[model samples]
Target chain A: MRAYLLARLGWAVPIVIAILIINFLIIHLVPGDPIQALVGDFPTPPGYAEQIRKEYGLDQPLLTQLWLYLVNLAGGNLGFSFANRQPVLPLILDRARFTLLLMLPALTCAAVLGVVLALAAAPRAGSLYDSSVTAISLIGFSVPIFWLGQILIIAFAIKLRWLPAQGMISLRETLTGWAAVADVLWHLVLPGFSVTIYYIAVVARVARASVLDALSQDFVLTAKAKGLSGRYVLWRHVLPNALIPVATVIGYNFGYSLTGAILVETVFAWPGIGNLFIASIGNRDYPVLQGIFLLTAVAVVLANVVTDMLYAVLDPRVRGSYGKNA
Target chain B: MAVQPGNILEIDALSVTYRVRGKTVRAMNAASLTVRDGEAVGLVGESGSGKSTLARVSLGLIPRKIARIESGRILIAGRDATRFSETEWESLRGDPVAMVFQDPLTYLNPVMRVGPQIAESVRRHTPELPLDQRVEELLELVKLPSVVTRAYPHELSGGMRQRALLAVALGCRPRLLIADEPTTALDVTTQAEILALLKDLRRRLGMAMLLISHDLGIVASACERIYVMYAGHTIEWGGAGAVFQTPAHPYTVGLLRAAHAVRNAEGRFATIAGDPPNLAELPPGCPFVPRCSHALAECSRDMPERFDARSGDPHSVRCWLYEKPGLGFDRAGTG
Candidate 1:
């Protein structure tokens, strides 16, 4: 098992490097010039542009710039954000904490809710509860995340006044300790729900289908024939088997959740990596963009590796194959 | 005092039907059989002949929503069990009766260790007993290695998986065991070994068995009485020796001939002409009439009733040919 995990992690090294190169290329190739965006429509004096470009090493050939970037990366430096005027690593990390605070809870809640609803609905595949869950999931999956976030704000924040409309916390409050935490959580309500609702639908549908498939397996009959109760058979034999596929779905969606968070964070003005990502894009903050891209890619790859490990833990057949390969 | 039935299972004229895409399928038209205490019985038939369905019905394993019992009575341990609820059926299963299904690779949970799969029943049936020791003992009873308990189903060979499944059934400490095509997925040598194991276990445990198989030879070697089904009907049944030697129904005769040809290493082994009738749209009378070479005018008009082919013998057949014993004997050229 240890060998198998090491092999997977090893394979991820080249993939992360490839993503770093691609992120750099895509950012450079875009039509907008960081210098022009930085100066912001002001008539640039003749030598000001060249001086700034040379100062940041952008005056060098693309290949040379790429080499320097790679060298700096090896030395554990993400360079300075042109607009933020700070080390990009710390800037990205500071924003990442807030993103994680929102995303971790949203994803965990989505997965838990999805599994619970799937368990309830799969057993009664054609009942009213099943139909209602199906309908709710379909609606949640279909509606655009941005639109949904806005609507949630309008409903809870504008109409009912039940939640704060935007931002990570109330600026007026000088709260500390748990009070500060509570205020942040209160502000988190809208964006978190918007991000989580869509994923809940995604996870629940996948999990429901997986549970149904597990229920149809021959072992379920064997379990039932052993005089095990239906509930016991479901919980023991069905749920673990069903969760294997759902784990894959969750891991595959981790990247998409980052994209979803960008929109939700933007709409709510949450001070997360997603909001930082948008601001960096507008300002063409190359160092921060590269940092965020590299971090996101590495995170996604790690998520998949963790999922594979979970599969080994859940299924003996998978563990055996991994052992053989090792 | 009321007299209790001596049989461990009695399925009397049971008919089970399934609904599929707006059509009702008669999976079991009127099948009947019994397993007396400590006796092994074989139910042999072609695919879709309802042999497996009969086994499921006996165990009350078929889901009520998918299939309904049209008419019949099932008495388990002399108790009227036709009206048994799901809870009653659950309690009855793994105690008075347990089943080993076909394709052990599919039947045994792939993710579960062999030990826990067996202990699932042992723990339920005998909670006070030491589970680990009982699992080991059950494995030993099936002649599997004690170390096999730690392995998953896929790690084991086909024969080993079947043995593991048998151990699981035996863990229930059942009075009766229903093995539905238990050896079908195994190789020929493994098939013989499993049949032998089943026969030995039945003797040692004093447990009655209903061994379902399409292979007549496999059944003949393990069971005392044999029931022959075709198109969801029990056409011929008697002592295994008598039934094999003097199969009364033409369908039974055809099956025996087919089985015999294969056993003799005959290339291009004989198969009965025509396929079994679709239960959704069966012809009037006997379902086998279209395939029966000896089909008579009355055979297509209406279904025949069961008759004793020989006086003072339990051997019986459900065929118009059996309406007159001498006539059926003359046609089959057997006695």
Candidate 2:
């Protein structure tokens, strides 16, 4: 297991470097100048653009610029954002925490809720309750996240007045400690649920199909013939086999949830990396964009590694093969 | 333990129907059979002969929504098992009756270790015993090595896995064991070994066994009495020796012929001429009328009921030719 983990980490280094190179190239390849975007529509002095370009080392050749960026990245310097004029790494770090706070709960909620609903519906497949769950999940899967966020805002925030309308917290409150935490949670409901709806639908459908398949297996019949209660058979024999694929789906979705959070964050005006992503795109802030892309790539790779390890733990067949290879 | 002195399993006129695509198919039709204490009864049939269905029904493992008992009685250990609820069935399953399935790989839970799977049965029947000791005891009873307990189903070979399954079936100290093609998935040498092991275990444990298989040779070797099924009906049944020697029913004759013809050096084999009748659209008369060479006009006109094939012998056959009215058919001269 240790050797396997070390081998995976070894592969991750080159992949991350490849991602860094691609991200740098793509951001530079776009047909607009960051300097021009920064200067805006105001007429400037003749040497002003050249002076700014030289100051940021943008006057160097593309390869030279790439080398400089790589050297700075290796030293843990994410460079400075042209839009905010601050270190890109620290700014992303601040925003990333908020993004994680929003995403972690939503992801967990989706997984738990989806599995429970699927389990309830799977046994009586094609019945009224199962059909109802299927229809609701279909709607959740098909409806756009932005539109769903708006609908939620209109219903709970506008008509029902059950939750706060926007932002991470109430700006007017000077609250701290538990009061502050409660206020933040209160504000999170709409965006968090909206972002989670699609994932919930995806996960629930997968769980239902897999669990149904598992229940039909001969092993389940054997478990039943062994005098196990229906509940015991389901939890012990059915769930572990059914949940293997579900776990992989959940792992892949962890990285995918970030892209989904972008729209929800914009709609709710949440102060997270998704919001920062959009603002940086508009300003042509290459450093911040590269930093965010790099972070996402690293997170996705790590999630896949963790998922593989989980597979080994959950299935003895996989563990046996892994042991042989290691 | 000495063998208990009554029928361990009894099925009387048991008929099972399955609803498939809005049509009800009789999977097992009024199949009556029994296994006495410390006896081995073999059920032999082709793929759709309802042998497995009878085994499942006796164990109360049939899927309720898809299949239903149209009219039947199942008595296990003198208890009326026909009206058993799910909970009642659960209580009866591991203790009074247990089953070993056809395919060991499919029957054993892939994610579980062989040891814990057997231990689960032990826990169900005798929860007071320490689990590790009970598991070891069961494993040893099946002649599996102690280390096999820690191995998963995939880690073991087909023969070893089948042995592990037998260990599980024996864990509950069941009075009756239903082995549904227990050695079918094994190779030739392994099949012989398993058959030997089964006979040895039946003697040691003093449990009645209902062994279901398609192979006449396998059933002949392992069981004292044999029941031959054809298209959801018990066409013939008797002492294994008598049935194999006489084979009064045309279907049983064909099966015996096919079993023997395989040994011909020319690689030629006799086969039953046509397919078994579809359960949903069965003929009004006998199910085997379409495929039987000796089928009479009366055979296609009405179903033949069971009749004694030989005087003073328990051997019975469901053929109109064997019906008593002094037909002068000369049954002993035919086959």
Candidate 3:
């Protein structure tokens, strides 16, 4: 167990460093300067621009700038955002919470719904129910996240009036505590549900195929002949064996979710790090960009390590294979 | 008379028809048989002879929601088991006719230890008994070493696992046991040990058996009476000694020839030509007609009923040759 923790920590450190370097390079290599982006795009005098450049240390060479950025990062600072004047880490953290409130519930919902439907429609795998689920999944997987977000906004929020339209919450009360929590959940419904549709389609199809294959194994037959009920065979013998594949998909999807893949976040106007990251690219905000990228990189690596650990817990065979012999 | 003759299992004219690609496929064609107290009967067949299907039906392990008995009866302990409810079957299966599968490790749950598995079945059927005593008795009965109960299934050797299964089988003190290719997964040495253990259990407990296997030699060694199935039909039935000494039907002859050849290097093993008939596309006459070298011209024209050729012993054959000769009947690989 100690070894597992060490290994995970080992893989995560380099990932953060790599992301930091990449983020630093990308923002620096951009055509425009952060000093100019902070002031304005107007045709100002070269002398005025040069002083602002000097103040921000942008006039220094690339290596000197990179070294100072690292030193500043080491001194307990993430730097103020060029766009908002807020500390980068705090801004990113607040946005991450909002995105988490939206996407996590949707991800979890997708996993549950997908697994249930897949198992129910598995035995007659190519039958009407299976095909219908597959077709629905195909649509869910293919439809653009932004388009889906718009459709939900138009149909449910505008036409049906079943839900509120744009923005994070209603403009009525002081948005904090209970009201804040409820408001986030309510606004999150459309974006979260829409994003979840893709996961559902992918997860359910994977679940059904795994279950069908697991049920065909010799162990299933043995379970049945031992006088266990059909339902028991399905729940015990089939599901545990079937879950290995579904778990893999869900784990990888969890890592991908941390990247804050931009489409859903933008559609919802989510103040997530991905949105900040994208804008930073345009304005060449090197410090904020590197901070967000490093954090995200660390998150993805940690997620994979957690997934591997979860696998060993769920199936002893995996742990056994990892140890005994190989 | 004779303490009510503890005939533990009875399977009468049980037929199973499966639907595949919108067509009804007759997997079992009115197959009838029985197992009385302490009698080891072999349901011998080549592949696709409906041997596995028959075993499944007997155990009520068919996979579907609305399964039809199709026709016939299965009586266990004087109760009609043909339409036994799931709950009723669950109650009766482990206690009355515990089944031993071909592979023991697959039969035992991998995550569970050897002792707990045996304990589970024991607790299910014999709930009144104390745990340790019940386990120890079972271990002693199967001739497994005492420490086996604590070990995981993977820890034990193949022979040990088979013995462990037997201990579980014996946990119920089942009147009849179904050994479906019991020794098929083991080496020859381990095979001998398992067979010896089974024979000893039967002798001591008077446990009747319904053994299904492709190995004629194993069946001949273990069973008292033998029933030969070919293409869903029981083509021949008699004592094991009689069947082996004088196999009347062509398929039985092929099986005996195959088993006998394995013993000696004098000649190539005799083989039946063609694959077993597809259950979905069974021809009108015998299921073996396409593969049987002894098939008649009329064999494909109509279904062949039983031909009880040998008198006074119920030794039967399903073929056209017994009725009349020279309708282009040719018995190859035989006299």
Which parts of model 2 have CA positions greater than 4 angstroms off? A324-326, B1-5, B262-267, B325-335
Model 2 over residues A205-287: C-alpha lDDT tens digits?
A: 89999999999999987888888898898888898988888889899989665555799899999989899999999999999
Candidate 2 chain B minimal-lDDT segment of 10 residues: B326-335
Can you list the residue pairs that collide in candidate 1?
B285-B302, B285-B303
Worst 10 residues of 3 chain A by lDDT: A317-326
Worst lDDT run of 10 residues, candidate 1 chain A, spans A252-261
Q: Once model 3 is optimally superposed onto the true structure by TM-score, how far is the C-alpha of residue A2 displaced, in angstroms?
A: 5.0
**Candidate 2 CAPRI level:** medium
Q: A15-134 in candidate 1: lDDT tens per residue?
A: 999999998888888888888877778897899988888899999999899999999999989999988989998898898889888888999999999999999999899899999999
Q: What is the C-alpha RMSD of each candidate to the true structure, in Å?
A: 2.2, 2.9, 4.6
In model 3 chain B, the worst 10-residue window by lDDT is B326-335
- Candidate 1 lDDT over residue span B1-335, tens digit each: 13257788988888899998889999988788888989999999999999988988887888677799999888889887888888888988888999999999999888889889999999999999998998989999999999998888999999999999999999999999999999999998999899899999999999999999999988898889999998889888889888877777888877877777743344566677787789899877999887877778999897776888673458988888768637644424321
Tell me what fraction of the real C-alpha contacts between chains A and B each candidate also makes.
Answer: 0.74, 0.77, 0.27
- TM-score for model 3? 0.84
TM-score against truth, every candidate? 0.96, 0.95, 0.84
Off by over 4 Å in 1: A324-326, B1-4, B262-269, B329-335
The candidate with the higher TM-score, 1 or 2, is 1
